[model samples]
Target: MNLEILTPERKLYNGEVYGVQLPGVDGLFEVLEKHAPMVSALKAGKLKVLKDKSMSDTTSYAIQGGFVEVFHNKVTVLVEGAVPAEAGR
Candidate 1:
């Protein structure tokens, strides 16, 4: 699926991804290829980017609240701000 992470100041990431783990207001949820269409509220937490199914090329960011929309094999994340997570392992 194609994913784009955007903030008011700039775009963080824009490319193809295997999936993404989002910090939903209720908890955490994941969006994958061919996933159903929907939108959700996000909270301050880590956004995990799965670069591939092997989970070998993963990246993470700390986001300060946002909203996510999924449609047509694309995921768009609009957040207040985001920074690369130094503690990603």
Candidate 2:
């Protein structure tokens, strides 16, 4: 699936990803390739980017409360603000 993370100031990420773990308002949820379409509110927490199923490379962001939309094999995260998570590797 393709993923993009955006804030008012700039785009944080734009690329293909295997899946993504998001901080939904109620809890955590994940979006994978060809996942069903939906929209959800988000909370301030860590967002994990799964670059591939092999799990060799990944990214994480510290995101403030935001919203997420999943549709057509794409996941878009709109955040109040965000920064690269210190724990990313």
What lDDT score is found at residue 78 in candidate 1?
99
Clashing pairs in 2: none
- Put down candidate 2 lDDT per residue, 2-52, tens digits, no spaces: 999999999999999999999998999989999999999999999999998
Error of 1 at 24 (Å): 0.3
Best by lDDT: 1
Candidate 1 per-residue lDDT, tens place, 1-89, comes to 99999999999999999999999999999999999999999999999999999989899999999999999999999999999998644
Off by over 4 Å in 2: none
Colliding residue pairs in candidate 1 = none
Each prediction's RMSD over C-alphas, in Å, is 0.9, 1.3
lDDT of 2 at 9: 100
lDDT of each: 0.96, 0.93
**TM-score against truth, every candidate:** 0.97, 0.95
